[model samples]
Target: MIEQTLLKCEEMIQRGSSSFYKAFAGLPSPRREAVHVIYAFCRMIDDSVDEPEESPYSIFELRSHFQNLDHAEGHFIWPALRWLFENFPQSSKDQFMLQMQGQVRDLSFTHYETMDQLESYCYLVAGTVGEMLLPVLRDDSNEEAQSAGIALGMGMQIVNIIRDVGEDLTRGRRYLPLEVMEKHGYTQQELERNVVNDRFIAVLQELKGAALDWFKEGLDNVHTYPPESGMAVELAAAFYAGILDDVAASGYDVFRRRAYVSDEAKLLMFRRTAARYPSPFGGKGAAAVH
Candidate 1:
């Protein structure tokens, strides 16, 4: 029954984000199912905050719902999440709390004054996801691998911020640090207007540079995971990094269009990453996995 529920969660993830599903494809079943459950939980929380009209519960009610997980009766997500917490109690609770805290911030905190503040927000929203998934990928005792996972999560969040500038502004949020914007002579007013000028481009370039540095630092230890898990992380990072490349290819005109990696490009990335890592479940690197 739990397996069936987890399969439903897997379908949710596949429908919501094909890129993430692509990354998860390389994992063996055990880790893959764990990841699906985690993703489903995160998706539930994110939707509760981001789309209140569609959500069954309000943010406060969502918190209450999760807090009462032991008594949760009808929902598939609660049972799936309960199973995860029962099996991996070490970090899942704290990580979920942190993720919720970040969502709360999203409700009230729309602007950032410094990079430090922005990074803290990123860690809460994305880093905790890394923390949650680390145990499933490998032993929970490996501190270094856990740290790398957090860093990689942060890098991915930063990439999201960089890519979604226009969309974020439309929603009345400015994720870029106010200081960085001022330093580049890009004002909030200009950003809200979706102005694509040289200064705005420079600001984006700086943000992208910072994101790439985090990606490099975070993914430096991809070999830490068992072959397939490592390849999954590496491939996901490569896909996110490819978005950076797309942004550049668009000449940093983020205000003009959303940037994305093509499915063909992702397949190529999978092949290259698989070649570099040499998967244990391999026929021909990622070709067989996909």
Candidate 2:
């Protein structure tokens, strides 16, 4: 029954996130199902917020729908949470995702006054997703894996923020914190115009540097998971990293357009995954075992 539901989730994600479906293709089946389920839920929530033609309903109304689904508590996450809770033990970290997703649904495009606030928001929305997936992928509940998972999510979120500069502006959203902009001498006005000045480039570089550190941290931390679990993390990390490559290749022109890895590049990433699949922790093989 769970397998069927998981397949349903995968189908949902396939329709929602073509980029992710392609990247996750290299993941071993065991780890792939859970990641797909989680992503399906997230993609739905994100669409509710980011979709251009979404209903004119207020953020509160949208949040209320999920809240009602969960009986006014954690309904937004019920689609995924109910499955994990009824079928699998609820990891403490997984619980955080339910609450965090609700939080995101409640708030639309929070304007950050400082770097710290932006970091915290990113951790809540994206980092927590990584943390939640760690237990499912690693097949264990441990501090090291949880911490690393959180960092990995944070890194991915940073990359996403950098890539969405132009898109977010069009949507009346800005992920770049105000203090960082001021420190670099860019006003909110500059952001709206999507200016591509040297100061803007410097600010972006600074954010990119921070994201790189989180990616490094995530890579190191996932090493503790069994080799099979590590394979899942590796696949996701590799896909997100490709975004960075696209950003750099575009000369950080996120102000003019969004960045994306080409179909050819995505196929290459899939090939790399097919060529190597070690144990999540350590082992030699073409695929990781749970």
Q: Give me the candidate number with maximum TM-score.
A: 1
TM-score, every prediction: 0.94, 0.80
lDDT of 2 by residue, 41-139 (tens): 566556656662663344445456544544533233345545654544654544454534645643555577878877887777788887667666666
lDDT of 1 by residue, 6-29 (tens): 888899889877778888786776
RMSD of 2: 4.5
Worst 10 residues of 1 by lDDT: 279-288
Q: lDDT scores for all predictions?
A: 0.83, 0.68
**lDDT for model 1:** 0.83
